[model samples]
Target: MAGIDLSLKEMMAIDGALGAAVVDYSSGMALGTLGGSKELDLAVASAGNTEVVRGKMRTIEQLNLKEGIDDILITLTRQYHIIMPLTGRKGGGLFLYLALDRERANLALARHRLKAVEEAIAV
Candidate 1:
């Protein structure tokens, strides 16, 4: 398993990566962040995405679904955003967020690689 820094580093290595962050959805705070440009602020994005996760979770609870969320994908005209909540005990209420440049990204591959990175997270 990898630590937060390592995990963030690995995420930034993915093709078209614009930014990456490990966020606590419960508190809308980022534990760590990497690779964000002036236009893409990882910390601000983390907090914003926290609401997205919470809203989805609330929907799931309202519907009484047993299954949990795997990931959330938001495709913009110029970018792709991925939000992956950690399912492990240690990682509960936390998630990994990644933003990519759509022009350079292969969505399928980015999703696959992000999943791998999520699995390898130690905290």
Candidate 2:
């Protein structure tokens, strides 16, 4: 397994990756972050997205879908935000948040890379 630092570095290697962060949804805090521009406040984004994840999870429970969330995707005019919640016992309630330049990123590849990052990331 990769350490958190290395895993975040790998995530930034993805083409068009604007920034990436390992965030704790419960606390709305970023444990590690890389590659954000002035326009992208990784910490603020992390906290805001935390609410998004929590809201969705609560909705799922209310609906009684009996399903687990894999990830949440938010597409903007210029960027793509990908929120991937970790699943293993050690990773529950934590997630990897990635931002990409829509014009330069390949969404499919980014998704695949994020999944690999999640698997390798050691809490």
lDDT of 1 by residue, 1-39 (tens): 899999999999999999999999989999999999899
lDDT of 1: 0.94
Q: For model 2, how does the per-residue alpha-carbon lDDT over 25-82 read when each residue is reduced to its tens digit?
A: 9899999999897999999999999999999999999999989888999999999999
TM-score of 1: 0.98
Best candidate, TM-score: 1
Model 2 Cα displacement at 87 (Å)?
Answer: 0.8
Whole-model lDDT, model 2: 0.93
lDDT for every model? 0.94, 0.93
